[model samples]
Target: MGRQCITEVGLWLPSLRPGVEEWQQMLSSLGQLYVQGVKVDWLALDREYSREKVALPTYPFQRQRYWVESSEGSDKTTTKHPSATASSPITELLDRGDYQQLTAMLSEKESLTAVEVVQQLIHLHQKAVAQTALRDCLYHIEWQIKPLDVASEKPSQDGQWLIIGGEVTVTQKLAEQLEQKQQSCRFVKELPQDYSELLQLVQQETELPLVGIVYLNCEEVTSHEEVLSQTETTCQSLLELLQALLQDESSNPTKVWVVTAGAVALGEHPISVAQTPLWGMGKVVSLEHPELWGGLIDLEPSKDVESQMEYLITELLNPDADDQIVYRREERYVPRLVPSSPSTSKTFKAEPTGSYLITGGLGSLGLKVANWLVQQGARHLILLSRRGLTEETEAAVAALQEAGNKVSVMSADVAEITDMERVWKQIQAEEKPLKGIIHAAGVGRLDTLEELTPEVWEAVLRPKVKGGWNLHQLSSSENLDFFVCFSSIASVWGSAGQAHYAAGNQFLDGLMHYRSSLGLPGLAINWGPWAGGGMVTAEAEEWLAQTGLETLSPELAISALEYLMSADQVQVTVSQNDWSHFKAMYALKRPRPLLDLITVAAERVEAKTEQAPNLQQRLEVVAETQRSELLRQILQEEVALVLDLPITSRPNPEVGFFDMGMDSLMAVELQKRMSKLLGVNLSSTLTFDLPNIEKLEKYIIDQHLVGFFKPETDEDQQEESFLETNLLAEIEQSSDQELEGSIDQILESIID
Candidate 1:
């Protein structure tokens, strides 16, 4: 068959050859010829290929393999379960109701995670097994649970230390004492004044592992220029040094202590005015990176250093120490919170004869203050602004003049020394002795730290720092009855985006102290946002409101100012805030110790949380038909509260809120109140977006209350949807007259 096929097909298979090597060589040569582009036809073998199917027997077979014997014990009954062997010691202690033992074990266990400890405590509390004992145990266990996985308890073995600006005799004495205690120390005596050079030095010095201590010694300034220059240089140096230290990974110091000789504790002290910035910056730096901050020590320059050395050394060694600010006394040092008390009287008198000079006096706040002065029996008033009198301010001035007071308008820049000098000369020429000065001239710029440039910072600081300095210098010997520098709460609690503004206000606070020390009458009022006027822009007012800051009314603010005029305190912060809301919003990033001062607010928040269901939960149970009416009442109440209007006089639904005297500050307050009441996250511009009560009500019902009232079943949901669609279709199909009637009915129901 193969030979016949080969002859017919002109092909032959390799099996036809007797020698295997010869046939393989022949096939290889043929394949090589094909690779060389030679096309070959089919090759047939000696035998023909065919396929056939075969049947198999169907049978099941059982087979088993022998298992290996256990390595330790051949008997399975002698072995224990894996779960029994893996039981945790913490679990055992907890199950035994031995909370004391559990806490001790947790404290000593190096391998146990904080999560495990927390879980055990939670389980014990949930089970209601020895509740009081578990609570006490949990409190003790909390101290062992570190927030960050840091080696906080580990002491630094490196003895080298870096001390900046400890050239003062007192600090030098302390340094000598530390050395005598066998501690190695190095002092950078000639501190760099420029920020760049200081940064470079910090980088170089921090490259090696060493603790850093910054000392801000009190220094006297000969002139206003010197005060500004020194303060600016010191602040810049500190800021740069902090930045460098934060970025240096090779030498992450356990703690950085900032020591200053100033009255940082809430009080009036005159000699350490320039040193106040250190305190403010120290506070903010600590908040920014609590892990790296050691503490802020404010020493009395005259106090002996020998007694405090032990406490200081303890603070340096203990990274987890709490008290951030300390002040020295005769025998011991203590922490202090700046205290503010109400004024003794509801009203106070201003100088009757001398003119009251108000910088930025043409602005809204300035004009209001002018009116206040006129009412306070001042006959002469000087209003200073860069653009002396715009059409609006001109009208205000005319009205003030009509009210039987002499109003003088000056076009001059308060920040410019020449402009300020020129104005001072004018005040002197008027023959009305400058009995009082209100340094209200300032600008507020909201920018993040990264966005702050030299120009932006200078713009904000110039009016406050330079203007305050100029006013202070020009009126130092004027025998003024009162020198009030209008500051802001930003200085007290650092605002998120107002670093420059806060720094500027802090300088004012410091300057007030300086004046107080010299027996000069001075007071710095750290006022919150003023309702209807001042440096707060519309955007700023909205942001402040959303953050739970309420604006002070003009009447209340003026009354407070009048009372403060006779108060003995040099610096006081005045504001009406919703502490619960403020804390919730502000503490989202991190906790603030300053907020602890608002004990009343904290108590109120706790009470609210315990006493009430949150707005969302309350709204969820309300019927859909009743929600619109409920929202209307809430909206009206909030509006009345914000606008300071009578609740009975609900404004016409068709009228715009802005037309009804709702300004930016009021709008923000209304938005916040509505959001809180409705349990909805409303926009800051809700009032603007909706424009009136009618539109706002419809928007709330449509957007927030859509699924607020959940249906009990799928059938109910479908029925509700069908009804809503049919109602809409019927309304669309109805005549214009019928639609008007339906709208009137709805409005009447909501309004009623």
Candidate 2:
């Protein structure tokens, strides 16, 4: 071979050194020989293999797989090395840092060369890359609103202000503040419930062009009725007002500022979470109707009326795009997205002192989190959802329970505070104070601006915003290590159709900030489209692909979350986007300040190597003899991409995918790509049913393309032709007497 860079030298070789055990020494020696293309005798180890067998596995065959080698079968061959010698003392070895001596220590038995250590590291890095492809390499884009302090600007560009839905006292205080600044204002005690009337209120309330509309209607909630009532004020009311403002013929551009007192938590002060929905919706409105939309202003809960008014006036008149503002004391705060690095630290251990509560726990996302939580040492779990413990969810619950966890399944809505309170009481009664709350309860459908009916909007908002508030209110006193909410990327950078969803997720981000401000444990993850069964429909998923948005694998998304929980972050957006494709597509719209703050989700650009057409189409032209091989090549290419291997390094046609670092999440990913490629909805258990490329290829052709194309020769006729052509040859190896006896037995059976 010409001189070429050899970055890696080991593939199957295991490093060998002094003081190693006999079984491993033999294994490593065999591994070393195998890489050098030396074949070992397999029959020589047959007896040893037989001695190691004790019992069969209980789970389904070919389902379970992992990286670490098992020591179960090593007992037979495990023994102290006969000619081993102890290496130098570790301290002495460190002092010298001798390359050859260190190698000698690693492979005392074989005297492993220094080159082997370098080779092993390269080999291990390959394994590390494979593992990262499934875990460390996964990330999603998130928009964090980092707080920036600034001096208040003087009032300029005066216009009349519209104030809607506030108590008489607060409204009067605000109106007086506007008057002192030479600004005319009007106050509506209660916003009109009807949409047409909201149109009229905006047109009739202020005579001249309005400077801004301030809505301060969010209040503390005590029941489900109040949750809906508050959402109507914060979400529905704002929706109607923005629509009316846009439809009016001559309404001048006015910033519609939503002010909520004690609605968002910045420190540990009380939060009127009922107002939080406005923040979620405000972000959406900022995108959908930027001209008519103002920004979100969260006022602190305080009894000092004069102080509150002074700050409120200062924020309203300040000229800037500081839309997402929070006023606490004399300080003015705004949000910016800061790039974050995910941690692998062991600091985020799930404390077993208190039970974990997962709203929407029966849903797929909730269950995934619950399973991860258990793995992190959580002992007690309360899985609360509207439809709790159904046929499917019950099985998952049973599995968690069988694993020695206390899993309580409750069929109650998290949106209903009473229900959550009842669940809280039961947990407290067991002396397990709630340690963490995962507010995953959310429901939404894709709809354009016109399609976002009041009913549709409220239905979507109820679960996430109202439910999040309920969790926050009920768990205020709990000794919790984390209060995480599952937010969507739709809010971070507005989704065209999902205005309400963006709104709900926006509230989650605000809630985390509220918690952070108050010195409480909180995290809101603005997740991108997820691969595992999430809200993204097949059509939507296809669209996502075209837009260069990668669906987040469940394994990666959850692992990223566990790491982020330990991070000092109030909010983080996790999304997988091909920066090359995403930025190109996103450029169709005006540049969003939020997108500017996004660090590229991943440095690894998606490989554009899948050139295979529909399998059936490819099979139609290929000869029958070559069909199996052709399909195998195509499948192996797909599998290799998922395994993060080079295309030329196609996996063995007969080796298992799971054995090649393809976890269930990767399996899900492969199934998705294969489904799209072949135009068939493959089952999620596709990998298990057909364990290897050979089996998978055969299954695909047999099941999907059964009669789509004709074989060159009929299979049945080919078998008959074989028998006809080789009648004597078929029995040539059999003894004459045995053949005669077989004929006589057949004749006797026929006669009987």
Candidate 3:
């Protein structure tokens, strides 16, 4: 293969090979020659000269393997490799060679054999490869190409300020303004009065705390014995400022920015005093004007002012920041769509478009859902998974690209708090709201309840339940439309050995119901045995047979998802018609009859009587004594537990239990049960407050609790105590058995 090393900025890779070990030497040489030292990331190799590491892992068959016969003596010992360490620079470097070879082959008119290429590449000559090596390398590299662009810098949330020209007035004013706004800023301003004293002060105060810079006219500065006296003085002052900032714990150790008005001026004074031998020119810029620097420096701007000042500052201040971190194989490749923008090929319908988010998006269901959504004219599709993609996943991404859909893939673990937070921040930052969530990533272990440990339950439930609920909470954004929680049918119909998985999925289902009742539209897709991709295969079938349920085809499951996505609103109850049907195993708990509940209540009261004093006799005796102080303490704790809201010393109406904004779902359930027990209507409004249990108890006594259970309330007693109509009679009169069921049944029906 033909290759050449090009050192010019933005032009590193060429189509020819050089006959020298240039990796380390290039850095030293660049440090000496280039005004700005070479910028590179250990993780992402930018500038074709640096090596590339595959961002996504490859399949075993797609990677080359070399099995050499054991060498003799010390040579054999040397050949036996030590276990790979995570931080080993050698491992990182060796990995880059694969990318280098592929790029070299790609640059040439005729492809070179893997062995032939490795032999020519002196560092990798001893690395062995079998006959299928070259093909495998190409397969892996196919999805590793990310195009290079300067605009790929991380966007700042702290906001930015830019200084232009030789005037320090605007710069100083801007800094003060930003300071008032509680923003951090730094500036490079020319010192005219007491230059030496000013330098000392800048050195002392302008450390890491510097957030912006103010460039003053060089002609107004003190003179020095340099070639360009005024420019040199300005540069020297900046250097002093830079040193002071680097020294101070608060000041940043970044370059002291110098501003020029045009590209012509920038070219003449290319180097700044703040420039370091390790870091090139510290970054450079030429702007048209100063005032427009801050406002017009947006990446997706419509104006033509390049905002070179902002670009320079970003490059210099960003620690270990480089576009090269994006894994790339060849310099020629370009992404068809911009990473920041979602460009959908199909138009969305007038009706709200259902968007689905898949955690573990780089996995099977995640990828499938992404593709399926694109086909359904989804306005946007988000892949929230770990920061990895297998070789297969990358290829799948490429296929989505060919199909003309935009796909956003990010690294995150559904279970980890930090990962979930990052995902949340990414969504907020990108302004992408998720409508549905498909939690397909979960850990499962076959164990009975006795065998299941807390650690195991937490590990499984974190991703399946807690992770789902966290997403649900975060999805309170108005843009959120519906939440779809993927659960296992095993939750509804318990599996003996898979008690852990069943428990985990059951938690998900319960949360789903809770959210739905609160009026947050959602569903729990209780999946049956899954086939095709995922944790199932022919071999898996044998193990799964221990738990008797017919496995579901992956295609059919996906189709069902598609159907739901298209329907106005879908509530499906899917199960195989065999003995293993999910319905057969779901033994719904029987609801207690009204008469039965009355007996249970009487029994509970009788049990409590052993600890209680005779109220009638106690009240007559207590008329003679003040209330006990102990009663106050007990009442306080009881209030805290029952209300589950912060209590104030004074009765703050806003801090009531219902005023805490408990969702409609929780309010309804609590109201239903209390109404049935006390035979009094309970307010379902989140803001309704009951002063205390004593007040409720007194009201109940006055109303004769049983009388309040009537279908209609007496107008005279309405304000005294509220109660819902007789719920038992309403259900008893229903003609349909399904409709006659209580609140639990209604919830199940909605979910189904």
Candidate 4:
């Protein structure tokens, strides 16, 4: 047998006792064990090993029983006893201090025991390395604690297991398998206060095949007397605790176990009776002790329905599953409902009769919309501007007259009821058949609450809210054919510094709702910034070029106008081109039917999947779709006044192109597009289905929708003037102040 060293004791045994008796006993046992072919080279011991107390003397290298012969060594031999007295300076340092204090005290000393000095330094270095490793582990633990979803693997190293007794047993196993995998073992001890230290010791020994933890007994739980009763509870508690630990996101175990009473149970099992809402979960397999409190087992599901959810749960519970968990996000796919043609039409072919009234006609958008109306079919154009249409108005009027449309200019503040009444009278006396009214008068300002005043609020609200009501009053006359109001998009998305502007716009939105409820034929177009014009242009350009956000362009603005004017629609809110469907669906002030139309309109258009193959067919399609009894009657009157077309002749497609020559296919397509225009479903097949012109005419007459159409006759025009004036007066008399409070209340309800 060879002499056994205590310098490597700390590595082999988790806790190193510095008592002389323990070290001597261990040393003597290692010596006897070495005679039985055990090879011992180094030992790990603490500063307590340097204490002075012994019952025997050393013969240095004699290798006798437990004590060695010190002076009898041949040469170059050194030995250190737990009680050995030192003469060298370095030994003097270790004799008075522990490893750390010794290094600090020996910095100035030299020429000491080389082996002892080097061994102390090595142990000190190992301590530092161990401390750093432990700190790193703690740091990882803290990080995992934050999300509780992250998992980490323990260090993979050899494991050392120590049994404490009169004659203890030491076992060396693969640290990886021992610390993390399904492991089997027995112990005579219970749990301790310094549980982490115990766990750390076992973790350093060997790696477990599955997830593992170490337990220590703080003198109390370690009593052999408590081991029997606690055997089952300890095992149950341990199994429960291990199962719980396995569910921890920081450390997830693949295999589970209960090792006690000289037996090891290894398998998969559910942690508890608590049900998990996992899809396709399987049943739990029973354990042996069914009569006693039963332990839980694993559940397996056959379906893939719960795959992603189950995987997420598993990863969350055991974030330490290496690279097993992944996170990803997907975007929603929403189709855009953009129009094919974007550029405004070069010019329109028709004109409105009598004089046209356009409030805020001096503003950029007001001017543009008014100009477009003139070019379309308006013969009489009236400009009602704040500055009374200055040099710009004169130039615009000249352009209109040159284009063959008459122009009229009037001065009135749209927000003033008196001014509105004055202008209404003047128009009625001078322009007896005033046909159109365009309320483009409005104001927009940017001011925070600190800067906002009652005057500012009144100024913003007057034009859009009060002015809208007043304009409605003034325009509500029997002679007026169309009433159009201009609104802004800021009403939908409240701006930071423009609360007043938003309020004003929202007021207009409500007015639109108000009018539609009254069944008034009106249009309120909430417009986006027009291209190359208005305050929005500069702001939009600055934002896009400098910040990358977008603003509305003219094409989108004009498209909104098209929906408003062409459809005779109200509460039409504009948006950036990308939000066509969304804004039309959600942000607009139109009726429920409008949203329903915007939703299903594209679907209807798609229903007319095929188009006319040729240009002539396309023209025929348009004409046939527009053909109705009412249109035919108007055409008959117009032909008599212009060209003498044979109205009595029954139009027959079978004959040569003489009898109105409208094809059946073209007629159906025409009806589809016309239905979109009329906001009603009018079948184009009516042309072919009701081939009798007289019967078709009666159907159109009986529908009476033509009465709601454009006022064509002199009598119809007169009735409009009467109704518009009376309704305007009535609306003007009714103060809308309650509306603001109601709107706020409703909005609060929505938010709550």
Q: Which one wins on TM-score? A: 1
Backbone clashes, each candidate = 1, 24, 35, 68
Per-residue lDDT of 1-752 in model 3, one digit per residue for the tens? 22235344453432223764666566555544444544434224334565655322111111223577565432311111212112233334467766664455332536778775554443222122211121111000011233334465554335333343344654566556555555556554535434344434554563333344444332221111231233324433433433333344533322234432211101222222111100111111101111111211111111122323343344333423121111111121211111111122343331224445677677766676666567456645567766566677788887776765556677787766677777777666654455666667777566443344546645655576456656666676646545666666555334444544654565465455545545666656666555556655556554343222445544445545544433332223333222311111211111111111111121122221323332222222222222222222223333443345343222232344445444323333433434534434443321233434444344444553333222333662563343334555564465443453566675676456
TM-score of each: 0.55, 0.53, 0.31, 0.32
Model 1 residue 430 CA deviation in Å: 1.4
- Which pairs clash in model 1? 266-338
At residue 291, candidate 4 shows an lDDT of: 14
Model 2 TM-score, 2 decimals: 0.53
Over 283-350, each residue of candidate 4 has an lDDT whose tens digit, in order, gives 01111111111121111212121222333223322433121111212111111222222233343233
* Total clashing pairs in model 1: 1
lDDT of 1: 0.64
Better of 1 and 4 by lDDT: 1
Ranking by lDDT: 2, 1, 4, 3
Write candidate 1's Cα lDDT for 1-752 as tens digits: 66865676643434335565875777776777667766565333323646444422111111122577568632222212222334445557757989788777444556668798896564433333222111111100000111221345455454545566645565666667656655566566656555345545655654445555645455645466777786676666666556556656644564667766553533343455565666565655554555556667665555554455665665565544333545445223433223345435434676668899999898878888998888678999999989888888888899988978889999998888899889888888987899999888888667655456667767887788888888888898797989999988777766766767877888888888778878898888888787775677666666676666766656557666776788777777776565655655544334444454444322221222423445445443456654555455556655666787665445667788989898655665676666665655555447756878889878876777676643356776688799999998997698766776999997787556
Residue-by-residue lDDT tens digits, candidate 2, 72-185: 633321122111222224434547876566455453346557687666544333333333443323333432444443365444666787788778788888998898888887
Off by over 4 Å in 3: 1-356, 543-548, 565-573, 580-752
